[model samples]
Target: MYDFANSGYTTVVITAVFSAYFVGGLAKGAHWATLAWTSALSLSYAIVMLSMPALGAWADLHAGKKRLLMLATIGCVVGTALLAWTPRLSGTEAVIAAMLFIVVSNTFYSYGESLIASFLPELATAQGMGKVSGWGWSFGYVGGMLALGISLGYVLWSQAQGLPASHFVPVCMLITAGIYAVAAAVTFSLLPERAQPRVDRGIGAWQQLRSTWQGARRYRDFVWLLACTVCYQGGVAVAITLAAIYAEQVIGFKPQETMVLIFVLNLAAAGGAFTFGYVQDRLGHRLALSITLVAWMAVCLIAASVTTKGGFWVAAAIAGLAMGSSQSAGRAMVGVLAPPLQMAEFFGLWSFATRLAAIIGPLAYGLVTWATHGNQRVAILATTVLFIAGLLLLLPIDMKRGRAAAIEKSPA
Candidate 1:
């Protein structure tokens, strides 16, 4: 169900549909709207991260974990429903509305993730944390692939019938939202309740926040892992967010062509998630992550130079492989390294790091696009450095060893 939401909500609509629509149609002439939307989205991520630990602590203290998840998921579903009306706005109204949707939707997404993490056990040892996370990602790709394919068929069928192009946009948004709402309901029904933290004699939110910060500093490698995550994750976000627009603007793909390309990418990503997650369970997260980053670097370089839709399609498939594998393996690594009872708090901070990149990656993309006079390829080329830098930072950290160390040092 989480995977369902991930694919339909995050990948299809946020990254592919509305993002492309906004850039290619809504404010085509005013690139600043794209810039503002990306910037605000990133900032919202930081805000969520900064506050998530406190919120997680509060949930623990209040013994209201499931209730919080319900609230966050509801907000995301409602906000996504509102996205159906996004195209109807114009000028400043469009920009503001898009930004609001992205921020609010993302906030709901991140908080819900923290809630889920609260349930993962503190120990599994050799199996690693990759399996579950990878399952979510793999199925997410499947869901996204299904949604994109259906939406694409609808658009192409409508076009063949000489129907208006604009009609498909609202329909896609509504479908994405409805499917997500259904998934949320399914998740609530099937997922088990998380074990609430035992009351800490007198621990308050501030104390938990301080302890989380201090505990984080005790593990020096955790900070470096976060740095790597920020860089690579930023690259991923920037690539996913802008790929549709880039294909439309630079690669000269029409709407139907773009949808097909995105569908292919999702298919490739689904394969990557399943394969790499299984492999990482045996091969180790560090190696798995490093391999994916290297692949991403190569993909970015080729994408930057590619001009034709064929070449872009090939590059998108390659990027999808990297995207799926990294997300699955990376979260597993985080789950391994995080403190035993502080999983939610740790994952919350990890979310912040990824979202932090969300801020930097998109703003950088927007800034480069603006500075280069709408040459999106240049912006893409610059993001290749993020991949290389991240791989380099990840080289020294042994994820297996890190997880062992985290486990050994955990309080009973």
Candidate 2:
């Protein structure tokens, strides 16, 4: 349910509406707008990358995941809602305000994301983790589609009224934040915080983070998992952050049309996650992930090659399937491999790796776009290399050994 709630922020703000609005509306379609948007998102990811592992460990030590989750949830919801005020500022001020607000909101959003994911191991056994994680991700996509659907309806209506984006996009922001707030209220009311700590108080979370790296070889497969995530999730990050921009820029899609496209994409993602959950458990985690990475590579190639709108839709739908399956598979793998007592801490490391990828991927795309004078095809083509690299790294992982080490706390 938390996934259901928080997915709205990603769907409407990060992937669909606000990004397009920030780049096209507020920035007046400035050449630097796309790069500015990616920079702001990357800045937030960097903040989460640096801070979350220690915070997760602290939450474990103090049994405060719920408390911290509450704080993060409120911060994100309020910060997102406040984005409605951006359009009221002067043009330069609005751009700056949007960037600042996105940084704050997305930071909190990422924190809540990591915090909620840490609960997986408590709810599902190792053998069942993949299916359960798939269910969560699948439902999360439904939430995303719902939020985008609602926002799209309003955007269509407001366009019919001949209102410009300055008026309507703010309404979408409020709508997104409202859904997030109401839905998260349900999550907090029903979800249990079940963490039991076995940490040494003298070894603080920061020290543990350092020692975790120092003892990297002890968790070799897990480290390899992170490495693979950085490679592939970077590709995913590019798609998520730039899909709307790409549609607007390269495919000549109108704002409302892009929203509708994304809504359908979310539907595809939901189906993919739901089906692939059981498939991951049956086929083995690494194999399922490798398949998704191959699919992602296809997405990059298809996207790079397509010039027409129909062709782009095919690429977008395939990207959606790969996105949902790959993200679910990775999270489930973490659940199967993390010690129960250190669940949050390990997931925090997972969050760190994911966020770091978020930074590198979009920044790379942004730079490529800038250098090529708004050439998105070359940027997208470059993304395939990340997926291929991730697939190759994935082959070396032995999930059976990783899970055994989690249980035994010794090298496999």
Give the number of the best model, judged by lDDT: 2
Among these predicted structures, which one has the highest TM-score? 2
Q: lDDT of each model, Cα atoms only?
A: 0.77, 0.91
Enumerate residue pairs that collide in model 2: none
Model 1 misses residue 86 by how many Å? 2.6
Residue 117's lDDT within candidate 2 is: 95
lDDT of 1 at 42: 80
RMSD of each: 2.1, 1.7
Give the Cα-based TM-score of candidate 1 against the true structure: 0.94
Instruction: Write down the worst ten-residue block by lDDT for model 1.
Output: 117-126
Stretches of candidate 1 off by over 4 Å are: 61-63, 122-126, 409-412
The Cα error of candidate 1 at residue 262, in Å, is 1.1
Model 2 quality (TM-score): 0.97
- lDDT string, candidate 1, 170-263, tens digits: 7777777777777778878977655565666588866886876776656557777899999999899887777877788788888787788888
Cα shift from native, residue 268, model 1 (Å): 0.8
